[model samples]
Target: MYFIGELKGSSPDLKISLYKWNSKFFVKFETPDLEQVYKISEMDVSEDEIREMVNEEFIEKIITRFKEMYQDLGELMGDY
Candidate 1:
């Protein structure tokens, strides 16, 4: 895999890694215990465009979910 780009300081506490393998693009998001991968292909659109869209939308949703999960864990542990 070749490094494409990274979105850092764009989200709260997470960083997104973008990679390319041949004709496919990979979006990776990692935390302490979880790693998420999203694949993009050149179907009707260029891979570059898809990568941009994933950065704007998919990564946002993943960060939101991570925040929600962290909050839930804190509440469960009575850290409120």
Candidate 2:
């Protein structure tokens, strides 16, 4: 129910967390590659709300973005 940090690589690495409370879900984003963690954002929503809002097209778009970002990161890290 959360869209934590996006994965951008051959394997997706997520820097996000999800929490549930009272049948509602919350997502939290964390800083990448640090000894200490910092929150970037948070959102609360219900399962039905998510199912209604997020569809296949939206998910595909996200996957594309992650792939692009992952490739870019790999290049930067000289690991590709």
Candidate 3:
């Protein structure tokens, strides 16, 4: 149930990590400097008591977004 959020701000130097446990999804956002961390409360979801509620599309989208964010950060750091 992990899902990545849309990118915000300029420079594309932000990083986001997402993971699913049981039926809940958690997300954490960090800056390129790794000195700042923010939790996105808007995209939280719970899978309580739902065993088969997981969807493939949802997981795919999350991984895609994470990759894009990572690439954007790499570009900003001249590692692309």
Instruction: Kindly list the per-residue Cα lDDT of model 2 for residues 1-80, writing each as its tens digit.
Output: 43433222212333434445445455333334321122322255444454444445654555566567667778988963
Alpha-carbon lDDT, every model: 0.71, 0.43, 0.45
lDDT of 3: 0.45
Assess the local accuracy of residue 22 in candidate 3 as a C-alpha lDDT between 0 and 100.
48
User: What stretches of model 3 exceed 4 Å from their correct place?
Assistant: 1-46, 49-53
TM-score of each: 0.58, 0.43, 0.36
- Candidate maximizing lDDT: 1
List where candidate 1 sits over 4 angstroms from the true fold: 8-12, 55-57, 67-80
Model 1 TM-score, all chains together: 0.58
Which candidate number has the best TM-score? 1
Better of 1 and 2 by TM-score: 1
Better of 2 and 3 by lDDT: 3
Lowest summed lDDT across 10 adjacent residues in model 3 is found at: 45-54
Q: Local error of candidate 1 at 79, Å?
A: 20
Q: What is the lDDT of candidate 1?
A: 0.71
